[model samples]
Target: MKTKINLIFPMVVMALFLFIGHTSAQPAIITQWTFDDTIEPSTGEGTASLIGGVTQHSATMSNGWRITDFPEQYVGSGTAGAQFIVSTEGYQNIVLDFGHRSSGTMSRWAEIHYTTDGGANWQVLANNNGDLTPHDVVYPFSFDFSSVAAASDNPLFGVRIVSIFSPVAFNPEAPDSTFAANTAYHRARTPGTGGNPYSGDGNWRLLEVTFAGEAIMPGGAEKLTIVDFNGGNIPELNVPFYLTVQTQNINNEPTAIEIDTEVSISVTSGTGSLNGTLAQVIPAGEHTLSFSDLTYDVAENGVVLTVAATSGMVLEPAISEPFEVVYPLENIIAKWTFDDTTEPVIGEGVASLIGGVTQHSASIGSGWRITNFPEQYDGSGTAGAQFMVSTDGYQNIVLDFGHRSSGTMSRWAEIHYTTDGGANWQVLDNNNGNLTPHDVVYPFNFDFSSVSGTANNAGFGVRIVSVFSPVAFNPEVPDSTFAANTAYHRARTPGTGGNPYSGGGNWRLLEVTFLGEPLGILPGDANCDGIVNILDAVTIVNYIMTGNVHPFCFDNADVNSDGLIDVLDVVGTVNIILGRVRK
Candidate 1:
């Protein structure tokens, strides 16, 4: 499930940032003109609609629908015709493919014209003679424009396709009457360089024109995120596997042409970890990075894998967002719903809370709610609500909960915990960072196994403190307004190596669940003095002689860690006490 720890009871002023959120993948192909369809798609035309990976132009069946009038028809003069906009940032080649009905004369055929400016002028790239035989060869028509697209000073990539049907004069200039008039109904007007947008369609039909080349995308690839393997279809158990990295950068620019790069995988956190770098020159798009031979084993639980691209070709490295994979575990040590009860909603447990903590609809659904979140100031008042939980023998715990916030920029709240009865506190969130947006309240999760002193302590208590922040102004005394979101982001302490935030990071908290294995046995400390000594050895002897028995972390008590713990262990304990040999 999801998880939430304590809350930062901070109340403060206001500040906001214009966040477009984060950048995502860009379109691979700018525009494709296929005579079979429309110029744009239905509803999603604004972003360039796609049909089987090919972005379709509008399928104009109503106003501008006709037939190709072959290159033999009377055409217009000067580059003027249909226009379209294209965003070719990192591409460098111009490719064209067309189909003509006749083996027409070379000079009387159609031609392709391109422009960089909006369209006050035009330039010829190639003629339709290449594809005159109809689908001659898919890759037959192409031109290299490295000098054009690679110009660091220029960033424009617009083109207007026009046909030069018939010349006004065979030799000298013919009278204007000799040229086909496109305005006349049912007449095929020859297309050419320089004119107006084509209305009545006729002449050689343009199939597909592309402006593609190697695109040097920054940061490994784009929108580097993890998708469920096989669409969440395959079982994720003890199966041997190789992770498939869908390099969003299609061969279109998977890697800089002729340049090889190094790819590495590192497990920064969680139940599993990885360390290896692969030397590769990936001209192909999708790739497979093996872990089976790399010894990247995992617990039945899940792990977070992040890959980075290191290349000297570019100035900086490209790292990916944390990609998490959850291998659901069966054991749930304890669960708390805070659903109108101060007790565990699923398993047996209780919460010890303080400060502006109360039960309200802060979560929308009826549950335990805490407000005035993020303390009015930092320090002791930084606690909006707190709790103490014990994991009998469990380790690798999964903590999940629901959370919502308001007037928070980021790092406005914090979750703190102490396994040793509040003696010392640790920030549940490693450091300062705000990854969640406060547009709405939702479920969140993270593995708590990394925290110190968290496992096998029956009295393991936790505290949630609200740090002081000033992300809001005239924020009023925070009331029932801090709730739900259409987005997500919770504020973490600044300098924790996470995204930073000042204040206005108040929150509404609810439901928490902990999943882990119960501590199986007590340690060799038979006296429970937190240590194993000769006295414990005497106790074990007493148990044997008096028929008394018990299991401590039997693993720890078995000094030699041997299977036996009887008279045989007495000597071992004595040896440990004298420091002759440590247990």
Candidate 2:
């Protein structure tokens, strides 16, 4: 019967992003083929050889050395043994797809070697064959060409297929032939072959060997583009700032490519400094720098830049684009300003106001306050101002209030929140107690538990209403001291309220923490920067469909940690959008 060969397709998908520019323009193509075809004996030319009595045909080898029905076997002679060859001018990745067909054998060997100068010298590129018993072997094999040496003058390269039957051991007959003895059994030997003659039946068939060419499109030079800057300048003082950058493709297509790049900023003529590395997916369009605590004594005048590809790939000259550093005014005291016309009232130690009011300012005593409370301290209509505060789906809202007097005031504050734009509000937090003043600050905390809305419905503000005691006040206390009992709303976590004593000092409007999923209003809420648009959806889908997880997962893209992402997480994300679940 003619030799029977079965074709197996492994489950493997490979995707690579290449930066192409005019100087480094090179088209890449991935080649795949299995060496199972048979040719007549006379057809064997160059390195080709004949197998069995027939000309050229694939065969299932039972014994290690036997090439055909004759039974005469040939063992490996020296370091330069059996192999194949191919050419590489501008190649990036070389993929080998194969499957192991065995019952319960341990060791099976197959390796790919390349020679830069003809077949004279060969370097091992990859070696793969594991100890999986009853091996179904339905997985594609992939090897990155990043570690291999580049092809210079003689760009022509060839592949060598090395197959060894005998275990690696010192041979007494040919002492120099063997290196060391290996107790591990290799599947290359037949069962009946007495361990010496190399028996057992095993074969390695070349299912497919694909040489993927690199596609270096024009303008594909990998470089960093400064998109935006905070404070408008660098080398700024204790003032925090951010930087936005993008990675472009050869065709100038803004592809979300992550590059291992660095960023450093300094003054033009002055002496200020800031440095950091590019991390995670910079997205396609633009991104902002998350650096918040930078100090600059003088203004930034000059700027230096540098960049390089992670691997041996030589990036175009655009990698290092230098620009000037312009610094804005530095070091301005942050004080809370309030919109006085909004309220201007303080009832019997109680104040309440409607939500969605915008006329407000920062405060020195209170980070954010509602001005003009009812003159007298009594329970009345509306007392406080209601406003909305949202996070980029990364942080939660924490509100704190304090009564600074020795007066018994029955005080209380309630936090009403809604995922839908004020269409509904859920009571998140509430407080009630005596205001025995002596610089006492009570922190009312809300974890946004009910704020389980998508990034779309992430639009949420707070409606804060405080009530004070209706009792007599000690005349010893000054009126201005208790004139406006301060109340502040800050975005912070438990035990993380900065400068709580000063009330409004050092407080921020947004606090990005490493807890909870960034609010997902729609599919793309990967980084939870709070917009359920295309970017967010693409981030989630890419991770799920493709086995690539960029740092953007911190934005809520990694629904499950299965190493492989899928749509199941997207389903839960959809639930969050419907207000069915909170991330």
Candidate 3:
């Protein structure tokens, strides 16, 4: 009597939801597969199979179905999993529940991922899973697809459980592990035994795979409304912008806004790639959802976005007003990719080894290696690499480069600059402000825009040199071995039992670059001939009187700084030629 009452009570409440309300209801079973006899779903039309280069076969398990022959330890994370495909045409707030049991030798981490467009694309349910404890005979796992708008009603919806790397717990005493390709979080121990490696022969059994969701019942007509990008402002290329999508009735009232629906965005007309998460679900009781980090890579005059329903909830697709995407104002002045030789690949610059450092012909991080330094900490402020370039017509200069250091090298590097050629050099930031380069290639950036005489200078040079410890040493600190004549920061910790610091350790550079915004157009240079004279005045007059076009820049004809090309602008250009006004 007790079991009958518990099951009957929920069914009665679900029946009341059918006629009383359409927006809110309890989730009902959409599909289920016990896999008791075959690999087909028992409750709905779908198929299940093993994927990702793993051998599979059916066998008698303690309960339902089982498969053996998983990937070897630490080799194939994300390359093996079980896949299930089904249609969710009338469902919202979809949820998945499953039971898994793994052998002690199997990987302890698994991920739940899904695809909306068949198998063409897949997205992970971000940061949802953890270490799969092996001691449990049947571990139940539940994932809420309610927030993933793309997982909701589609013919090609599919879900999979893939193995991922064994996670490591965080500890402040030890440095974090270097990131590998498919890392996970939260480490787990083997069943009964403490720590064991994952093996290829381990067995994994699965059962009671079920999917449930709130069924959409039709009543009021709904429409999807897509807000324009950045409220119709011109967006910069590759810069992220926010967008909003809402579901409402034909009258578009706040009370009539539809809830719990999934909509997808598509590029109606554009040449570039539309990036970031393109689909999101409206919350349970909310009508609008925002995707805050959307971006387009190429500049286009007409980029139109359309939001449409993958589920049958919305009647028509909502179209956005066409908007322009413009290029970022900053442009690269010079770039060097030292693939085979240390030479500038773009623009003009002279790059060379400096302060007794020599170039090695072997690939380190970059193809060209700058090596053979002075004795360890001997060239504290005088040795390393130097680059001389002219920012003749550019302002707001920024320098960027990819750099790496060998284990034995000093990690501290100081940036020095000379504004009036190489006659006088000063560290860009004092000795205490040195940068620490890693063994793995990493980027370093310097902004010289605010420095005096950096812009429009024909004599600009910068250097990166090793530096000694600038701070007084204390024996209580972890780095007490560092002396005044030694590098303040060690690339590798001293007591870690790695290679010792030596002068032979080197630094490698790649993709060295200088970026700046071009200076404003020369005043009164209507022809853009790099000079302002009588010809510029004549050119301004010609444009105003006969509607003639300037050979170079029409904007230069507006010499009076007014937003028009008229006789007043021509008079302003004449005054500059006569030296009555500053050029």
Instruction: Please tell me which predicted candidate would have the highest lDDT against the true structure.
Output: 3
- Please write out the lDDT profile of model 3 over residues 4-107, one tens digit for every residue: 11222333433333334332546777787777567777788787888877556563323446666667654666768788887887888887766666666565
Worst 10-residue lDDT window, candidate 1? 9-18
Whole-model lDDT per candidate: 0.42, 0.37, 0.66
Residue 476 error, candidate 3, Å: 11
Candidate 1 lDDT tens digits, 1-583: 0011111210010000001111122223334444345554222111222211122223432212113322223334323334444555554443322222211222223445655663456677655442332211111234444556522112455544444443322221221333343321212223332222223233332333333434544544442223333333332333333443434442223333223434555665555555333334334344333333233444322344554555523312234344443333445666665555667755556676565454443332634555443322334334555666666556666666655554343334457776665676677752232324443555556567765456655556555545443233222222212332211223432233333232334455555666775444434554333567777887778765774433234555565666766776677777767777744
Ranking by lDDT: 3, 1, 2
Best by TM-score: 3
Global lDDT for candidate 3? 0.66
TM-score of 1: 0.39
Q: Residues 378-421, candidate 2: write the lDDT tens digits.
A: 43323444544333333333333332221212234455555454
Candidate 1 has an lDDT of 0.42
Clashing pairs in 3: none
